[model samples]
Structure formats: C-alpha cells, structure tokens
Target: MKIAIIGCGNMGLAFARAFLKFDLVKKEDFLLVEKGEDRMEKLSSFQPGVITGVIGPQIGTYDLIILSVKPQDFPSVQEALRAVITPNQVVLSIMAGVTIANIQTVLDHKAVIRAMPNTPAMLGMGITAYTASPEVDMTQLRKVENLINATGRSVFLEEEEQLNAVTALSGSGPAYFFYVVKAMIEAGKKMGFEESVAALLVKQTMLGSFHLINTADKSLDELIKAVASKGGTTEAALKQFEAGNLDETLIGGILAAQMRSKELSKG
Candidate 1:
C-alpha cells in the first residue's frame, strides 16, 4: 500500500527509514510532503524513488496519510488537507497533544490513529504508544502497528486519554534520564576523572543498570538493597538520597510533566 508522510522532519524520515528497512513500503510507493526545498532535496538523496512536495490534489493518491507536522502547524495543514482527503484514505498522526478527534475535525477522515513516538526513534529503538478510532479496520490497525513497531516497541492503549500519561512518561522520560546522566558525569569529573572518562563510565553505568533491570526479576528496591551492602559506598549515596527526599522530588517532576501534557491540549 502507498503511504504519504507529511512534514518530512526527523520523526518523518526516521519512520520512512524504518519502514524501508522492513520492506513495508518501497521507495517508489512512499511520498514525502515537505515545505523546504533543501529538506526535499536532502530526502530525495536518501531515497531517490520517493516523491516530495507540498500536499495537493496530485498527492491525494495515497492510501494512508501520516501526519508528522508540529502541533502549531496543524491549522494551516488542516486547510491544505481539507479538500484533498478522500474516504479511501486513512490518517495516522504523530503530532503530540492533537487528538484523533481534532484530526477528524480538520481532515474529516473516519479512520484516524494517534501515536506517541519518542526521541530514541532516531536510533530505531524508541517506544511508541498508539490508539485508533473505532472506524479503523483490523488490517489498517495492524499496518499502523507495524509502522510504529518498525522503530521499536508499540503499546496499544485502550483509552485514548492515556496518551497524556504516555507523553508524560516515555515522551519526556528520555530527557529525565539524560538529566541524571549529565549529573553523574559531572559528579565523576569532580571526583577526578576526565570528561571523556566520566562520560564513558556514566554511559555504561546507565546502560548496564537498565540492562540488569530488564534481565532480573527482582524489584527495584530489592535491587537497591543488593547494591547497598550494610555500610558501603552505595549505602552512603542511598542515605543521602533518602535524606534529600529524592523519590518525592522525582515524583514532583513527573507530575509537572503530566500537567504540561494536559496544558498542551488547550493550545
């Protein structure tokens, strides 16, 4: 089936590359709708057979149209799509905060899907959470699932509103990890390691720690206990974290992210 990706930005090109990797769509069958000449030219070189241009009547030939534009660009994009959408098409959106209902109000397509794909998708190892309108057929749902899974994992949230929490968690979760890693690197450097050494150490610590969690059946608290032997270095750090209410501080930050997610819906 032919797939058209609107707004050929990072997420768009990443999705395109993943789809191409899995042979879900060939270069010729894909159309990239982008506004800038430079970006269009760049994507053309990446996949020569794919077509790139502003959305128009000629581009309405796609069976599935994926929206990858930013939220603020939606109004003008809606105007552009109003006349071009046909019932023969399905719409998949990766734009945050803009709901499936909002998309329907603009593009007027019954088969709409909204997905939350995070930053790590650039490396094809991100996680995406998505849900679709009831109008979407099983085949279309599977196709979209495959598309989201092309990069990494996919979670199907039964209730559409759960996307707000998904956005709060996974969507913003990477930045949180980066914040911790940055602090760890700085701490290492302050302790006498060079910048490069600190980075290597912190990166592997974060990576290895997560890998252990993924492999182990132990609870996080149990894992902490395992690392913190009676009066060891890990215990000292844990004591400091407890004294500073680190867990409560973390919860507050996550709650702030959730609130921001809801706030974006108002925009």
Candidate 2:
C-alpha cells in the first residue's frame, strides 16, 4: 500500500521503521513530509521513504495518510490536507486528543481512524487502541490493523470515547511502571546495595515477574499470595501499600489522566 506520514518525529519514525522492517511498504511507495530542516537531514541518514518539506497535491495519490503532528499543529495541517485528500483515501491519525469525528469534520472527509499508541512502539512492543468512523470499510480496517500490528499489538474499540481510557491506561502506563521500579531501586539502595546493583536486581526481578505473569497459570491475587507468605516480608510491604492507599492513588491518577484527555479532546 502507498503510505504517507506527515511527521517524522519519534512516534512517526517508529511506525515508519516498523513498516519498513516488516516489508509492509516499500521505500519507494512510502512518503515522509517533515518541515524541520534538521529532521529532514536526519531523515536522509536512513532510507525510510521519499522525503518532502511540505504536503502538496502529491498527498492525494497515497492510499493511506498518517497524521502524526502535535494536536496544536493540526489546524495548519488540515488546511493543506483537506484540499487534496480524496474520499476513498484513509487517514490514520496518531495525534493525541484528536478525535476521528473532528478529523472528518475538519477535512470534510470520511474513513478516518484515530489511534493511541505508547512509547514502547519504538521497540515494536507497544499496544495501540484505535477507533474508526463508519465510513471505513472492513477491508480498510483490516489493512490498518495489519499495519498497526507491525508495531506490536492493537485493539479496535467500537466507541471512540474509550480511546481516552486507553490513553490513560496503556499510553501513559510506562511512566507508572518506571516510577514503581525507581522506588524499589531506592529501597534497595537504602538497604546497602550500590545504585547499579540495586537497579540490576530490581530490573531482573521485574522482568522475571512479568514472565511469570504471562506463563504462570495463577491469577494475580494467587501470584501475590504465593510471594507474600503469611507474616513474610512481602506481606509487610503489602500492608504498607494498603495503609498508604497506593492502589487507590494509582487508580485516581489514571482517572485524572482520562479526565484531562477528555478536556483536551474538546478543545
């Protein structure tokens, strides 16, 4: 499929690299529109696609167009995009807080798909949640799904509103995981381990725990029970977490993120 990506930032390049790595789109068939001179120079470092400084009528020829610019930059992009975009072409937007309905309305076009993807997509281990307008047919949906899967895994939501929940949960999830890991490492350092040693220990433990979560037949509660034997050290940590309402705090923070996402979407 002929694909055009309007921005060449990290997330955009992540998708571009994945598509090229998987042979999903040829370098010749791919087009990159980036306005930054330095970014354009950097784009030349790797042969991802045909690079251009601006969007033009040539954009109309592509089967799919990916909008990866910042939410605030869409107005300028929309004016140019709307003029040349054909009705049959599909637009996939990865810009945060930008809704599919708004894209369709702004461009006076249909068949728009909006997706929320995390930073892990750079490593091809990301999870993306997407929603599409009714005008996107089954074939186009499947094609877009296949392209998204190249970055990792993807889920299609029937309601676009759910993307905000996804944005809160998975899109911003890595930072939460990192925060917990940092705390664990700090605790290890207080107990006498060097910073590097503490980091290695905590990182390995987290990695192993993740593998167990995937491979073990036990439920999360059961797994916690297995580690926190009655009156053990794990039980002490669990008690402290409960006392501080850590779980509730984490949930509240995610809800706040969703609320803010909703607020941004309205603007």
Q: Pick the lDDT winner.
A: 2
Poorest stretch of ten by lDDT in candidate 1: 46-55
Model 2 per-residue lDDT tens digits across residues 1-267 = 999999888889899999999999999999999998999899889979899998899999999999998888889798889889998999999988888888999999989999999889988899999989989999999999999999999998999999999999999898899999999999999999999999999999999999999999999999999999899999999999999999999999999999988987997
Backbone clash count for every predicted candidate, in the order shown: 0, 0
Best by TM-score: 2
Model 1 residue runs over 4 Å out of place are 48-51
RMSD of each: 1.7, 1.5
What is the C-alpha local distance difference test score of each model?
0.86, 0.93
Q: What is the lDDT of residue 72 in candidate 1?
A: 86
Error of 1 at 26 (Å): 1.1
Give the TM-scores of the predictions, in the order they appear: 0.94, 0.95
| True lDDT of residue 168, candidate 2 | 94
